[model samples]
Target: MTSTDAVPTTAPAPTEAPSSGIPDLWFELPPGFLEFDLEEDSEERMVRMADAVDPLFADATPEQKLSLVVSGEYILQTMIAGGAEHVSACLLRMSDGKLSQATLCVIIERPDVGPESQDRRGTARRTAVQWHEQHPDAEVALIMLPYGPSALCIRDQGLQLPGVLFGLDDPIPTTIRQVQFCVPLRTGPGSALFLFMTEDIEHWAEYLDVVSGIMKSVSADEPDGDSKPAADNPDAGGTESQA
Candidate 1:
């Protein structure tokens, strides 16, 4: 497939962040990458991301799981509850051979609770919406949150999606198609990845391959190939969980 050795993962590495570089796990970047690092947990791999998802599938058999290493409350509190900070989001497309399944990913830093309180979730949605709008040729929705609870919510919601999300009252906490995964950030930040269009499941592997390619290219462009742990502070939080 075709790819470029450009751009970079946004979140900088914190003390607890891993330095192994792109991991050998199921998800990976492409081969032509010059520099890249893989941690056990990536923020772009969360659940709330699904809120941004649109009509990507008819019905998907979702998987169930949980990550208690760092409770969502704890992560949120540790970061946001502690004070103010910046968060980053990402947009990804799962290539389904001829068609493409688009997804949006996000990474929140010091996420106890940000200034965008009323529109906290909106912050992420807006970012994803803008990306899709800018690239109308691409798919819509499919949002992801690098935060922990968002990941938990991804699996929680993905399993009961489609019909269960009609009420405008609650407004579908997870409007996008999202999935939760473990990240290597301190306390291993939680991550969410939303998958728009259940039809893409038939071509999941191929689409994932495209994602892997992009990830590799991003890593290759990293200045150090990977983020190293901080010497002064061992539990320095999630610095590399950038984007």
Candidate 2:
């Protein structure tokens, strides 16, 4: 395995808006948070990225192409916070000034492909195992989220923060590949997973608390007769939910 302090390069603007089912649109940014405007065609950018790395897609076996179908069809918008610069749609800093770094990446999976929640966990474990086999020196684990409903927690050995998976729809053939590649980035600290975070070992607890707040803010359903506005929802930082 190789490591580089390089940043992500920007891709051409996309022509279409990515589709998502999450209702809450607005989100409150933590202090020092930086927002990025994603160009359209996130999936296209990812395909191009894979080609750059492998280059022989046309001649690869069918299974190889399927494995490469990690990003699915839609990449969705992203909200990044912490001490780092944004590069293109899928890249970020390897490490942030010794401070913690976290990103909320929204992904859409069709109801057709992959396993459901319980099965998804098994798949995640397999992915982690494969990752370790490739990079033996790298640390990896398949843990459960501390709070919220039972969900698989994917984290690197020393990463203070781990990305969470929030599956909005039922498993379908179209969305089956969503689990193929959870994170958009193929290298660096955050890869093939959502909610990537890297921080000092001692700050792990602090980072978990911060990420929890962000997840609490996410709600796909309209605030029912009992629900409160997103901003009121501490997780959302007081922002409206977008359709």
The lDDT per prediction is 0.29, 0.32
Identify the candidate with maximal lDDT.
Answer: 2
Please report the candidate that would top TM-score against the real structure. 2
lDDT of 2: 0.32
Candidate 1 C-alpha error for residue 91, in Å: 11
Per-residue lDDT tens digits of candidate 1, residues 93-132?
3343233223323232334542323232343455455655
Off by over 4 Å in 1: 1-97, 109-177, 186-199, 212-221, 224-243
User: What TM-score should be assigned to candidate 1?
Assistant: 0.28
Q: Alpha carbon lDDT of residue 141, candidate 2?
A: 55
